[model samples]
Target: MIRNTRSGWGSISRWFHWILAAAIIGMIGFGWWVNHVPARPDRFFYRSIHADIGYLVLLLMVLRLVWRAANPTPALPADSARWTRVAAGISHAALYLITILVAVLGWAHSGAHAPDYSSFFGWFHVPQFTTPDREAARAYEDRHILFAYVLLALIAVHVIAAAWHHYIRRDRVASRMVASDAGTSR
Candidate 1:
């Protein structure tokens, strides 16, 4: 089914979930690698790839938001603690917020660097919000890194929480979002 019910998320939502998960993980890795590479040619190549993927991720995030608004999320497990439920809701919201913030800040950080550093895979140019300024770029870059770390921490918590539900609680909380072909119980 394309639409979610109270029991589990639909295939569309699952696709969005998994794709965004993979993209975010990849972007994080690329972010780390691009910063560490010393060779200008290698770094430029990595940065170009990273920029394109980041743009795709931003688009996917937007589509995911629209998809979420149009679909229903699974209900919380009946036996789940109230605090756990509250934390899950807050963390999920924070994940969405942080993802958007990081993308925007990264875009600005790239744009604020000298000579208009950002482009959509080098096929076209992306406009900058700020003029070239080293200090401003540094600030944006710092915040982007900080937000990326926050995103990573949240992801770790999210994974742990899902594992807790799957193993300790023996619940379908995590299964609801996984592929149906994976034998996820409804």
Candidate 2:
């Protein structure tokens, strides 16, 4: 099953979900590291790596959004309360929006800092969207860090919700993402 069904996620969706989740979480930690490390000659090297990952995340997020829009999303359990469904919807939307916003903010920051900051792993240069300006770069970086914390909080809630479904409700909601499509319908 390469595409999602009404009741469960397909392989592609699951892959995207897990891969993006890991990449986003890793990027957040890496960004923190880059900021906290002592200033050294190689500090830009670390920032470059972080910028590369941010570009990749932005690309993957766009692809994931397209895939999600084109596929069927698994429904919440019928027994779920209205509030649960609403919260899930809002959180999911926020996750997608904030992830994209963070990536864009990082890109803007890099663009404002220097043309070299937008290099995509040294393979090619991403066009700068903003002219080089130290103050603008600083502002962008601040907002980027703030939104990242918000993203982290949302991820925590997402994990807790999934755990609630799997452990407390003992339902298939969580397994719908992890389970094989052995007996599921397309």
Candidate 1 local Cα displacement, residue 104, angstroms: 0.6
Per-candidate Cα lDDT values, in order, are 0.83, 0.89
**Tens digits of lDDT, candidate 2, 1-186:** 889887888898899999999999999999999999999999999999999999989999999999999998888877779999999999999999999999999999998986458778879988878889999999999999999999999999999998998788877687777865532432
lDDT of 1 by residue, 20-45 (tens): 99999989988988988887856766
Badly placed stretches (over 4 Å) of model 2 are 182-186
Worst 10 residues of 1 by lDDT: 177-186
Candidates in order, TM-scores: namely 0.91, 0.95
Q: State the TM-score for model 1.
A: 0.91
Model 2 lowest lDDT segment of ten:
177-186
